[model samples]
Every structure is written in structure tokens, then in C-alpha cells.
Target: MGKPTGFIEYDRIPSPVRDPLTRTRDWNEYSLPMPVVDLQIQAARCMDCGVPFCHTGEEIKNGVSGCPLHNLIPEWNDAVYRGEWREALDLLLKTNNFPEFTGRVCPAPCEGSCTVAISEPAVGIKSIEKAIIDRGFEEGWIQAQAPQKRTGKRIAIIGSGPAGLACADQLNKAAHNVTVFEKSDRIGGLLMYGIPTMKLEKDSINRRVNLMAEEGVEFVTNIEAGKDIPMAQLKAEYDSVVLATGAGNARDVKLPGRDAKGIHFAVDYLTQSIKDNLDNGGVQTLSAEGKNVIVIGGGDTGADCVATALRQGAKSIYQFGLRDKLPDLRAIQNPWPQYPKVFQMDYAHSEAEAVYGADPRQYLVNSTEFIKNEKGELTGLRTIDVDHVDAERNLVEVPNSEKIWDAEIVLIAIGFAGATPSIFKDFKVAKTNRHTIEAAKGFYRTDVEGIFACGDARYGQSLVVTAINEGREAAREVDFYLMGETFLP
Candidate 1:
């Protein structure tokens, strides 16, 4: 789909990040932009494979290959290769509503499944995507696209995160009057608060939100749908309701003295830190200043805590994980086309190591207890070295391998437990065994008529791209339910 010999001539080029030492001092986005010429060269590397697996994003059971949204990778790659920036933007926006957010934050499963990755590195598909969209914005090619006519229908969207926003964007384009309800004081649910600004600057979110408003989508913030406004009122007012409240229930690290004063959930800690930085113009409250910090759970959330702590002037940081470390290269069972299961570095991990002079992660360590001081403040964490054993390979502590980690603040970044029931208290929507909203097996409809759920609330915690896909799908369903048929793509 690209130049005939492009893959053979051009090597894969990675997007570069700002200097770690300097970037750690602020919360601004740390990644630098690539010039369009270099980006086109990267796009030229897409080889003409018999079939494209980059965007056949399905249940992903076989492995994490294919784009969940089934993004038109080859089409857009060819456009970028020809310097057809506008065409590339149109193709990208066809599947993804917010490439700007995904460009900065998404893990890029698209690259992992790229046909070229079978031999050489995949085409710089993601970078080309970011470049195309960014170029579109720079040249004022993107604008508020109001529908030509009104469908005379209304849709109420709960939550302003990726899913909520995507659904709102689609439903609005279908000429439905859409109102997005957010419990927080601002738009962009987790996108606004849970994620650190450096990953996705709030300015970008504000810009899209403002454009949505111009296009006739209403955003109401600081109002809980169930508590502030009853579900009955919304049901009576809107033709359909979309519940996109993300799965926000944080998984707890069960250990003695779990209620220690310094213990914090990863999302809450990150939210407060980000809100404080945005509102107060600096990290005021929840500052990690001059304190020994121990972060439990070595996932993306944990990595974020480490970076936040670094920016807050932390004394020292340590991330503990009960699971064994991954291999540097892909294992035999983990083959190509599947998302690479090899050990890799993220922005926060790189920044932590560069600034702290050491990798902050320690694997195979299980936290057994939290040691607190006389006043009930966290002082340290007691843990034990463990190994995987038994038929289930459950973690087993090694005898005489106990150790106490010195710390003042402990951030639990163990992940989420799906959506909580209290938010759905009024809707009366049933939940599945996995604790997510119960909808059609292959659709976004709920048991209740005219009610729908998508994104993390329905699928459990997932990537931003997955959420966008679900939202779009749900909007299509809602539109069909309203009009008895829909032109929503």
C-alpha cells in the first residue's frame, strides 16, 4: 500500500521524548512532535501484506492483534506516504473519534499486529496517525461539523470520558440533541482527572469539548445522574440514555493496617495531584515531597504514581509487584501478530530510571502488612519474597525472606474492579458475572428499553481505543432504536 520498496529502504523510526531530567520538573507533555517529511517516510514502510490484521480488532481472545476499532491502517498509511494529510485525517476520523488522545496515550496494539512486524518493525503507523491529525488541526482542516438537519431525538450521555465523549460526538452527528452529564466539576471524566496532564494535556480535551458545544452537544458538569438528577427524569426526557461512567472501583491491596493515613488509591491520588496542579498552578495538596514512597502494583497506574511522585520531589520511590518479571524478548508461546508480551519501557518508567538513577521496580515481592507510626500515619511496609507454585501457580512466600520497606506514602495501583452498583441504583440495569453492565451478547443494549451501556462500564477496564469503539457502536444502536434504522457508521 506504500512505496514498492519502501519497507526495504526505510528503517523504522521511533517518536522521541523530551529529556527526562528536564521534563520531570513540569507536567507538560513530554513527547516531541515529528516533522511531516520524516513522518511520511515512516508511513512509507507499510508493506502490502495479503491481508491487514492491524485493525481487525475483535474480542482479542487469540491474542492482542488487530485494531479494536478496526482502524483503516493501510489506507491512512498510504495517504500519509503520499503527503495526503487531509485524506489521512478523514480516514483516521472514520474509525477513531479522538486520535489526539490515543496518539499520546494509547499503547498502540495496531503496531503489534502490523503485517510488516512479522519480519522488520511495523510501519510507524501510530506516529503517522498523530502527524496527520495534528497537521489537520494546524492547518485548520478540522472544524465544527454541525449536522444538516435535526433528527428531533434526544440522547442523554452519562460521563465525559473517552466513551461518553465518543458516543456524544457520534449521536450529535446523527442530528440527535445530546447532553453529556459529568459528576465532576469539569468535562472529561477520567480523561480530565484520572490521567495526568502530561500524558494528555487538558487543553486538547477543552478544544474538542468546545467544538462539540459549538456543534450543539450540551455538557453539564458537577451533577451526578443518579443522585443529583434521578434516572426517571432522564428516561422521561431523553429518547435514549447512554451510561458510560467508567469502571472506577479501584482494586485494594489487602494487608494489615490497610487504612493507614498515607495509603491512597492510584486514581484518587492521581486525580487530586492533577487537579491541584491544574487549579492551584502547582502540586500543593497530596505533595510527595521529601517522603519515601512505595507503590504497589507495577502496571500503568503504578508507573503514573512513580512519575507523579518524581515531579512532586519525592525522596525515593519503589514499585513492588507480586508477579514475576517478563522476559526481555517475546517468549515462544507469545508469537508475532499478538501484542508483544516482552518487557518494554513506558514514559514514566524511563523518566523514573533517568531521574532516580535506578529502576524503581522490584518483582516477586508480596506486601503482607503496612507498618504505621503512633499517630496512625504510614511509616513503612512489611513484605516477603515469594515464588509461584502449586497447580494454580499461586504466590507462595519463601521461608525467612521477610523484609520491611521503609516508606511514608503507599500508593496502591493494583487496577480496578469494574463499575460500582451505586451509580446504577436508579436505572435498575442488571450486571454480569464479571460486574460490568449486562447488555446484548454482541450489542450495546441493556434489558431496559431505550437504555444502553458501553466502554469500561460494560466491558470492564480497557484501553481508550476500545472505549471509543464501544461508544460508537452504542451510538449506532441508540440511533437505530430511535429512527428504526440509522445511517450511523
Candidate 2:
């Protein structure tokens, strides 16, 4: 325990943030640095409960009750409280491959299911985590742990997203010659382009990738497994193969006037904005300046679009969600220790409110079609309010609720359906119904003899933590399969 009465003595304190008005003007991260002393105080609040639901990492109502990584939360909390930061980092890295990435971007399901959150605010799990890892970097505690002996087994991992990176990190620990192939030009796949730089800085990815390189893990970018290099060649060269290609088949909004010039998928828009920010000398090439932006589908991606649009000087922005506004508090079906499925404002929401003077989300509404001008450029949208028939998710359009909304640009942020199927060809790997690789009923083994799959390629679009878990487990399974028994964890 951090302290015997620490929970009672201290209250929760979140990480400080920059004022939204000032922060939205730049592409840099907005989270202000937290002092180590203040973060240590917050870490002291961990109660170290007997059961410690925060570490269970179980599935509850499709959400994780605790950390999917099953991070040694309480143990690290104690270490942090005692100011043993190096020890804390060791504990954190024992399970997670990248605490810094998760600390910055992850939603922190651990906090939602926190025992303290049943009453008062939850422990500052995410903030404390961030503090620990950041301090580790600053103090030069983290270093490459190159394996003493090579197993002489070569492993090829396709896709360099969280799943692929995590899998490569673990496989490297087993002394396997791990080579990561990324289709994109950069090493971090989704971590690179999919997420906006304002939330997670590019240097974070660069630092980790460099460290992995020093650890003897070979990274090959701009060389897609199936297309650039034939899949059969990879299978022939590597003793074991892991398919970690993330679920990138973005779900699109099927509406009339879909051929309009200004309509774009969330990934395309986000990627373009990131690329512009990186390549065009900090200027947005796809600027939404002086435009009325209508964003369809409300989620993290939609919120990101809103923030990106605001930064690009959009005149007005509206994000639409077909679902009704959620209750402020947890519902009957939701209980403590299960991630609270209640209304919340993410970083982009606060930024939007700062710029627009209100939350821009329009709930229980549907964009019927994209309204286009004579030039086929999207000038607006025709929308209608919707009502779900019941919890079963039947929908009906409401009469007299139709309205025309002005928009120069429309972005669809609905989320992804599954992985692209073309890449799995030539390898002759079986597939599941969800379009992911077909693994053994309870294992990561695919139909192919020595091929395995994990992360979004096996389980569809999931959180970074879940992807890390999949990669770690898949590596363990791969080790077991190769050695006929294994010691890698």
C-alpha cells in the first residue's frame, strides 16, 4: 500500500492542461507538464484494495474492468508514493510495452473501474503512469535489453501499429530475430498517422522506435508484406509469422450525394491533416478555414476532426451522433468495477466548446444526405432527427424533424469494420467471420502451420491496451509453438 490511510488523507488531482483557447492555435501537445511531487501525491491515493479490481483486467459488458495489460498498478503506485521511480518504471515495463504511449492516449479504463471512483474521484492512474514513464526517460532509466543469445528463429510481423510493435517487442525478448514490416512510410502505423499529433507527440513514437532498433529489432517501413514483398516469400524466409495489421477498413456513412467533392472519411481527413502538419511546414494543406464543417458520426475520431477543423480556423463545426444523449450517471445495467458508460467530454470536446461557446454534438440526429452545389462541391447537408425503437437498436426517422444544415466539408468518423482482406491472400491463412485471421478457437494460431495473428487483425478494431495484450499473448503462444515449450512472457 502507498500509505495505510493515504486514500483518506488525500483527494484525487488530475493532470493539469493548457487553456484550450491558447492551445488550439498550435499543433503541439496541449497537456502541461506535471511536477513529480504533485504526481507522487496522487499516486499515494491508491488504496491497494484486497481484491484490487483495477488489476483484474477482465471483460465486463464489452469494456475492460481494469487495465487490459494487467499492469501491476498497486505495486507501482506504492513505489511511486515512496518516490522509488526507477522501481516503478521497472514494474510498469514488466507488463506494458509502452507506458508513455498509453499514458498519453489511452482512455484509462483502470480509472473507470477504480474502487475509489465508486464514491470520490478515482486515483490519478493515467497521470501517475505518465509521470513515471516520463521521469524514466528524463532520468535515463530506460535502456535497450538486447537478448544475450539469438534463438536463430526469424519472425516477420506485418503492420507497425500498437499490436505489431508490441508483438515485435515481446518476440525480440525471446531472442528471435524480429523484423517489423510497415506499409506506411513511418514506423508507427496507427500511432503515427491515425492519431493526431496534438494528443501524442511524434517524438514519442520516434524515441520508442529508436530504442527498439537499438535492441536488435529490425524495422522495415514502406515495404508492405503482401504487396511490396510477396507473402509467400515472407512465409518461406521467416520461421514464424505474426499478422498484426490493424483493422483499418473504416466504416463509411452511406448517404445520398456521396460523390460530392468535400466528403471524406475520418481516416483520410485525419491522415491528411497530420501529413500536412508534418510535411507542409506547419501549414494545413487541407485547411477548413472559413468553412462550415458538419462532422457525421460521433466518437474519438469525430472529436479529433472537430479539434483539427478548429485549429485550421473553421467558421463553424457540428458533430452528429445518431444515438441519444447518455445519462450523466451510470445506468442500472452498469455497475462500479465495470467501465462506467456515461457521458464524458474528451480533449477535443473541451477545445470545441472553447472555440464554439458550446458543445457541438447534435445527438439523436442523422444526416440524410450530402447537399451539393452546382459544382458538385458539398455546400451543406440535409439532416433528420432519429429515434431508436428500443435498446435492440431499431431506428426510425422522425417526421417534421428534418432540417438543412450548412457545411462546406463533411467528415465521416463512424469507426472501422475490420481488416482489409487482400493482404491475407497467397499465405492461404483461414479467416474468421469478422474478416480477421482465423485463429484456433482459444489460441492465436492461424490455419497455417507456423503463422499466428493478433490485435485488430484477429479481434477487429480495439483499444491500444487490448492490442498490446493480444500481441504479448500471441508472442507467448508463438514461443511455445517454436520451442515445443517456452520461457518467454
Candidate 3:
């Protein structure tokens, strides 16, 4: 242990963020770097408990309990606390293929399960993880090391998101000829488009992609599977095929005037906004400027829309959620080692509040209809307050709670349904009731031999860390299938 009593001596301090008011003007990252000494102190605060549930990576009650990647938390905390920067990086890379991505975007269930958090605040695990990887890059400790030999077995990955990238990296390291095909013009599917720039910078993704290219992972962009190349052709050409295509079928709000001119899916809006920022000269195809925006559904995506609309100079913003606000502390049913159900404002919510003088979220509200003008342009929405009236948590509208909200533009930010079915029509993979590929949990194989599935396509929408884990384990299974035995870990 770094320090037996360090957890008692030091209280948890979160990583500092940029001022909400000031950061709203630009499209830069919200996080600022912590001094090395401060980071070491934070690292020393790790409890290093005997069980260390922080890295257990268990699923409890439909939610993940710990780091899905099973990161070496205690070991790396000790290395960082001792000022062994290179050793910390090595320990971190042993399990995670892309710490840089997960460190920034993951919700950090590890902190929720931290032993220190049972009573006090948890250690800044996510911040420290980001620092370790960032420092590795700055100190020139990270470099490409291509495999020494090739097995001459060809493999094709159908997506270039986290899962596809992780699977490609692992398979390449195992001396297999791996190729990742992306439908988009650039790599990093959700990372490139679904996320806003303030949360995760595009350069960080590009840097990792470049490193992977140097390490002999071939990335093919602007080429979609089952479109440009037939799935049958791909199956015949490659020795193995792994489907990592993400869940693109977004869940939508099917209310009145759903096809109104200004109504759009949250992912479509975010994708266009990001593409304009990157490809065009910041000329938004779907600008929210000077319009009253209403975001239906509350989650990370909805918060991102609020922040994006703020930056784009929206007149007013509001986010509607079907559930009530979370409690200040964990509820009675929520125990330790399970993800805490508590209230905390994310970065976007804080920024919106700073600009609008109040929290932009309205809890326990549901949109009943979308009001539109004669030209078929959205003008407003009809909503009603709802409540969980039974043990099943079914939403029931409150009496006399009908209201009208002014909104020139509306974005549906509900979660995804599953993978787009049309893309896999040629492959003919069976699907589960959840609309995801029919792969038994843990065994990524489809019914068809030599074909497999993983990540969001297999498990439905989940965390980036979980996608990476799926990719790693899928690679292990594929290696075993090909070589009769395997050594991947």
C-alpha cells in the first residue's frame, strides 16, 4: 500500500473544471491538468482494500458495479503514488487498450464502488487515470510496437468504434492480419460524432488512431459493410469476421407532429453539428441559433444538446425527463458495491444553469405532442407531469398537469433501440428481443461458424469501457478458435 492511513489523512478532491460561463463561448475541453504533486497525493488516497471492489467489474441489479475494463486500480495507484510514471503507464496498458478515451468519457462506476466512498467521497480514479495516460504521451513513453510476425490469417472488423478498435488492436498483437472498416468518413464512430468537443477532444482520438496505424492495424474509412462490399464476399475473403457495428437505431419520441420540419433525433443533430465543426467551416446544417430548443428525454445526450445549443446561441433551452430527480444520497435499496443512485450536475447541466440562471432540466415530465406551424415547422410542445404510481415504475400522468412549452426546434434524446437491421440483412445474423445480435452472453459467436459479434451490437448500448472488455474477450475466443488454444489476457 502507498500509505496505510492516507485515506484518513486526505479527503477526496475532484479534478478542477473550466469556469462554466467562460467555457460556454468556445468548443474546447472542460478538464484542466492537475499538478504532479497533487496527483500523487490523490493517488496516495487509494485505500487498496483487500477485496478492492473498484475493479471487480461485476454487474449488480441491471447496472455495472465497477470498472468494466477491470483496470489495475490499486497497482497503478501505488505506482503513481511512488512517482513511478512509466511503471504506472505499463500497468494501465496491460488491460486497457485506450485509457485516453475511457479516462475522459467513462462515467467511472469504479468510484461508485470504491471502499472509501462507503462513507466518504471516493478517490479521483478517473482523473488519475486520465493523467497517467496524458503524461505517458507528453513524456514520450508511449510508442508503437508492431507484432514481430504474422499468422497470415485475415480478419475483418465491421466497425471502427471502441469495440472494433480494441478488437483490431488485440488481434493485430496476436499476429493476425486485422482490418477495420468504418462506414463514416473518419474513424471513431460515436467518439467522433455522438459526443461534443468540450467533453472529449477530437485530437485525442486522432492521436490514438495514428498510433494504432503505426502498430500495423489497417483502418479503412468511408467503406461500409453490406454496402460497398457484400457480406458474403467479405465472409469468403476473410478467415474470420467480427461484427462490432454499434447500435445505430436510436429510440425516438413518437408524439404528434413527429415529422415536423424542425424535429430531429439527438444523434443526428449531434452528428451534423460535429461534422460541420470538423469538415465544414463551422457552418451548421441544423443550427439552433436564436431558437427556443426543447430536448425530450434526459441523459448525457440531452445534456450535451443543452450545452451545444447554448454555444450556438439558442434563445432558451429546456430538457424534459420522464423520471423524478435522484436523491442527494444513495437510496435505501442502493447499497455499497453497486452503482450509486444520487444527484450531481454534469458539465453541460452546470453550463446551461450558468447561462439560463436555472437548471435546464424538468423532472417527471413527458411530451404528449409536438405543436407545429402551418408550414410544418415545430413551434411548441404539449407536455404533462408524470409519476411512478406502482412497484413496476410505470409512468402515470398527474391530474391537471397539462402544459405547453415554446420550442422552435425539438431533439429526441432518448436512448438507442439496437443495431440498424438493414445493415445486417445480408449477413442474416439472428437478433435478440432487445434488437441486438443473438450472441449468448460471453460467447460472442453467432449461429454461423467463424462469425462473431460483440460490443453494442451484441449487448445493446453500454459504456465505452464495457465495449472494450467485450472486444478483448471476443478476441480471446477467436484466437482460441483459430489456434486450438490461446494465451490472450
TM-score, cand. 2 = 0.97
User: CA shift at 172, candidate 1, in angstroms?
Assistant: 0.6
> How much lDDT does candidate 2 score?
0.88
Select the stronger candidate by lDDT from 2 and 3: 3
Q: Going through the candidates in order, what is the number of backbone clashes in each?
A: 3, 0, 0
Which predicted model would earn the best lDDT?
A: 3
Model 1 C-alpha lDDT per residue in residues 278-297, reported as the tens digit of each score: 89878469988999999999
| Stretches of model 3 off by over 4 angstroms after superposition | none
Whole-model lDDT, candidate 3?
A: 0.91
The local distance difference test score of each candidate is: 0.88, 0.88, 0.91
lDDT of 3 at 130: 95
The sequence of per-residue lDDT tens digits that candidate 2 reaches over residues 1-489 is: 878887898988778888998999998897877887888788888888877888788888788889989999999999999989999999999999999999998889999888888888899999988888999999998898899999999999988988889989998998999999988888887788978999989899999999999999999988878878887788889998898888878888888899999999888898988888778887787779999998898788899899899999999999999988888999888989899888998888899999889999999998888889899999889999999888897889998999999898999999887887675675678877777788852379988888888888788888888888899999999888888887866
Return whichever of 1 and 3 wins on lDDT: 3
Clashing pairs in 2: none
